[model samples]
Target: MGIPLSPRPARVIDLETMRQRQQARKRLIRLAPELDGLEMVYHLPSESDAYYGMPLLAWGLREDGEVVGLVPWMERLTPCQSLEDPEHGHFIGYRDPETEELFEDPPDHKVTELEQAAAYFEYEATEEPTLIQQLPETQGTHALCMDDSGEPWQLKQVFGWRLYSDGAVEALLADERLIDSTPILPGDACLYPGHSRHRVVYFFQRQIANRIRREDPATLEALALMVMPADQEG
Candidate 1:
């Protein structure tokens, strides 16, 4: 007799899997809120803080809702002395999800004077107080660099983006790519751009630095911002 062929594995869709997926979708929809009438502000995390020192974008939610803030990951330039020749100056930028305050040690690890000047020039050319007021009550602030001892430093400045929202803060946390060890809570701030429903949160992590090196050393730095469940605070 001919040997019987093994039965092919059945294509299956489990109820639990279906339910979980549906719940996730519903959560996302529930997170979006009407943010047209609330005042919003964006500020870079303080350099003195133990985390979030890289160029980050944070949004403060002023409207009454479950979602209070949103933040997104971003990269910035850092000035450095050429490894081959200390006298000759070269610059590089990194994306770090951890707090910028963490770099307060080994002052040599920080950005260069040229990078600092560039950041200032960019800020001055872009900031508009009147246009900011016209937005549905929106505000923003520049990023501050800190010294080795976690004290505020004036040399390397930073900036961030901001937005207001009516949805649940959990919605912003949906992106697995943005989630890091840093704890994101309901009270944390978030930034959402106009005409976009998904908002991003900025954070600092050492892995982000590694990512910068891997992505682009000369021009661009790509980093991941992760979101963790509120119950499992980092």
Candidate 2:
């Protein structure tokens, strides 16, 4: 008697999977107008109210009428009262999808500015070539640091790459490695460069990192992975 071999798994076609994705995309396309209308109803502040203290993330309208952004410190699920509205005035809230009725003050609404802005662009159907712009990179004002540990750190001061008269490019980064939950780089007893060749690699804002963690925590895991374990080093 011969032992029976397990049957091979059937080969699968990816067409159905691809079709589902296409259907999802089409659904977003259908909702494009509704998303665009939300912009008119909810107002994002044009400038920071607190000069020294600004939200980690904010959306601003460009001169040509495009909304550009920064990562928000936290996803604001509650509908923020429009900037034009008085602080004590009635705040507009979310609408019931099934009932098509607006709620005056909804508890636990799950919408954020990042989601709303991203969806607006995703829904738009465009055939024209995309116009792109670059935001200026400033060391302390506009950057964050990430070390080998995969935690997001805020920049203190960037002693970035130097292009010297001899044409050699040398760079050094100080790690503020997510200790004590403070995002800013520390003043003393911190990890400096040359300890690990690529220890401090990513320059991202903590708000953006938090958004990624919220949306897909796996992203942080990926960023944290090393090619080889530190213990394996000779």
Candidate topping TM-score? 2
Show the lowest summed lDDT stretch of 10 residues, model 2.
28-37
Q: CA lDDT of each candidate?
A: 0.26, 0.32
Cα lDDT over the full model 1: 0.26
Error of 1 at 182 (Å): 39
TM-score of 1: 0.18
**RMSD from true fold, candidate 1:** 21.9
Question: For model 2, how does the per-residue alpha-carbon lDDT over 1-234 read when each residue is reduced to its tens digit?
Answer: 999999999998899998866644422111011221122123234332421122212233322223322221111111133323332122234343445455443222222443454446543334542322112112232223334454443343333322122112223344546344333232323423321344433434445456544766666565445322431332
Q: Residue 116 error for model 1, in Å?
A: 43
The Cα error of candidate 1 at residue 47, in Å, is 14
- Tens-place lDDT digits, model 1, residues 51-156: 2122222222221211221222221111111112222211222223333222211122122322343335332223332112111211222222222333322211
The C-alpha RMSD in Å for every predicted model, in order, reads 21.9, 18.3
